[model samples]
Target: MPPINVIRNALVAGSAERRPAVLWALASLALSMLLSSLGTSIANVGLPTLAQAFSASFQEVQWVVLAYLLAITTLIVGVGRIGDIIGRRRLLLAGIVLFSVASLLCGVASTLGQLIAARAAQGCGAAIMIALSMALVGEAVPQARTGSAMGLLGTMSAIGTALGPSLGGVLIAGFGWRAIFLVNVPLGLLTFLLARRHLPVDRRGPQTERAGFDTLGMLLLALTLAAYALAMTMARSHFGPLNIALLLAAAIGAGLFVRVEVRATAPLIDLAIFRDPGLRAGLAMSALVATVIMTTLVVGPFYLARALGLDAPFVGLAMSAGPLAAALSGVPAGRSVDRFGAPRMTIVGLIGVAAGSCMLSVLPTRLGISGYLAPMIVITASYALFQTANNSAVMTATRPAQRGVNSGMLGLARNLGLITGASVLGAVFALAAATPDIATAPPEAIARGMRITFAVAALLAAIALTIAVASRAVATRPVRDEFSVGK
Candidate 1:
């Protein structure tokens, strides 16, 4: 609401002399994480209503969600690198404003096309927020507290995701589909104010681009990510000719991207960063774990309703157990990581997840909803631990100067994992079910599909566990307690 200089000067003059602003700063970061995740999830509930209102098919209305995802996927990493070159504070503030303004446009748009375009803009803002929020944690909290800070942000993210569907349903039912987007306006403004008031000022220096980096790498990476994302999402559960062509293009683009990055003066992503064993393991495990988690979301509903004979409301309630568990476990998970160390905690989390997946695979349907719910709770809570540890390890491993791009890389990994799970794992479910139309599949088929899917999920978790254990052995230099915390 106030000019940047006025607020900056006021906070600078008073803060530390009067009161510590650490709590407020963390709160602002937490809110930014929340808003970014909410932007991701809250739109799905509107598709049916949007289709009816616009007289469009489900496929047509789907773009409202797809555009937002594609925008984030393509631009997230590039924006993060840009933030490093410029100033994170400036970029984050701009992102909050853009996201807020886009929400307003989304609410007021008269046509679906306009709404989709606005959603894309909002996704760009979200990309910036998600990337920079994690990057700025070092400035907001002490090294000793990084784990807890990461945990809090993780909790907020889970809460945002868990809250979106239920909140969207209420807003749409009471006001209209428009209300869902409109609600973000006030929250975004508050986040902006808190951020402007509390976040540490971006260090004043003559900033220089790493090596006068041109835009080619970013463009190439975006197109490559875009092609892969489209391949995964454009035809859900169907790997048709188009999907194959897109996949080929993505592969070629990836090869070209690597070649370009290797030659660039200031590469968007430093290829050398991946040489760190712990950091590489963290990113790879994050993707693998995300894929496992997404499989639950995709397959859980059908298993609950069809296999367990639950009603619609019961199904919704049951399906929520995973997110709720994730939200509840986040803070504790972070604390554990901080106390026992991220590498150790990461292994523990993977084991828990693997155990839960095994339970899901073998537990008989005769045991009913309890069997399904129990395994989900275990998986979610364990995932919370893994996410916090992996994130903290990865962030701490990177130098401060490169944190933004590295953080963006973490997000990109998770996004790709989600996309992969939705397509590849979804196909696995369909095949295991042995049904052309999953919607009409009998209860036995649904149950069978769920079991088979989770068996595969457990195997994936085992693979992640293998990677984590193996990474520790390969670590030439263990991650220094996040830059020697408390030293």
Candidate 2:
């Protein structure tokens, strides 16, 4: 009913000091992003310790990470849509509380099963937090500054990721593997308090009351994602009848979800968002960025440890380079996106990733640790540039009311890329190596696998580059400020 700038001013009028409100909101959301990102990578360093502690096989112990990934990927969309309906702040605070409790449960678990379940619960809370954090940050800042806000969040995530392996290693060595999970409790509580004190409360309106929540659509979508995750995780080794059944179930569930969403008054995921070419391109690039990042994360340790004969500590150090690079470059990349627009930035970022991947593919088998460093830094810094710009682009293309689901879509693209990267790249590595057990494989085999995997990753990045280039002419529509707090 009012001009967009008036609506924007009204939203920030809750606090006399708009600058302070923006800072606090950014800080709180950054913390949420950091914690969730930490959870994604921290447990990885402790996998062997966990396996030994539980007297379980590596495959069984992997459930600790797999469970978290599955839960987060499956539930992020539904929970994000729920955040729009109830309140982003309320959902985020609750997520922090739940994450803390789940962390406690994980710390005290006596059996591997209990720990897996706790990790799943932790992932559920993480899904809530991760899905809303970006949306909230977008809502808090003016549209013009959205890129910078997203950059801050992206920077925190890089820091968290960089810290995860190093921190997890210290915790495992000092206390135990359980200490890794236990550490989240205090951090979660702190985040909860800060979010409660700083985050803006959602003001209910006619839109909130009128939007129908699609419960059945949510269920079908969850089932689809869960089945897909399971199928992907098992595809490498368990391509049996059971895996086939899971794949079929996933297909069926996806079909049902599509059918339900088309008819629902308020779909769990609004398919209409894909109509915007910029949003679609951004989502695709987001998936490609995730794939590149996750593939590097998944494969780098093995290459460093096995091919170069680096120890665990050295491997951790080597892996930290990319995140460090990402952290350093994130803010500048965001600011650049704000000034120059996202398309050119995204294209440059993807080209950098492809170039880095190409370098990795041709790297010599017997090399110094320094050999890995340069390529990783390039890849990660490029990812930082691409991510911040793409995120800003996606947010700019949609209305304020759609932020929740659009954020969810972004998260979905990321998780799907993660799942696909880990599974598909790992499978490619294994197949290239001609052995299922890559850890124990010969140095030559490991090197070969790494080269092939990196080559494939480069190709994926190249494809994403093409998409980004093609979408350069598409204009970003202004975000509708229809749901401001005071309006």
Q: Which candidate leads in lDDT?
A: 1
Each candidate structure's TM-score, on Cα atoms with residue i matched to residue i, is 0.93, 0.90
lDDT of 2 by residue, 79-109 (tens): 8898888878888899989988999999999
At residue 276, candidate 1 shows an lDDT of 81
Candidate 1 local lDDT, 400-482, one digit each (tens): 77888988999999999998998889999999999998888999999889889999999999999999999876663345664
Where does candidate 2 stray beyond 4 Å?
1-16, 208-210, 364-368, 476-487
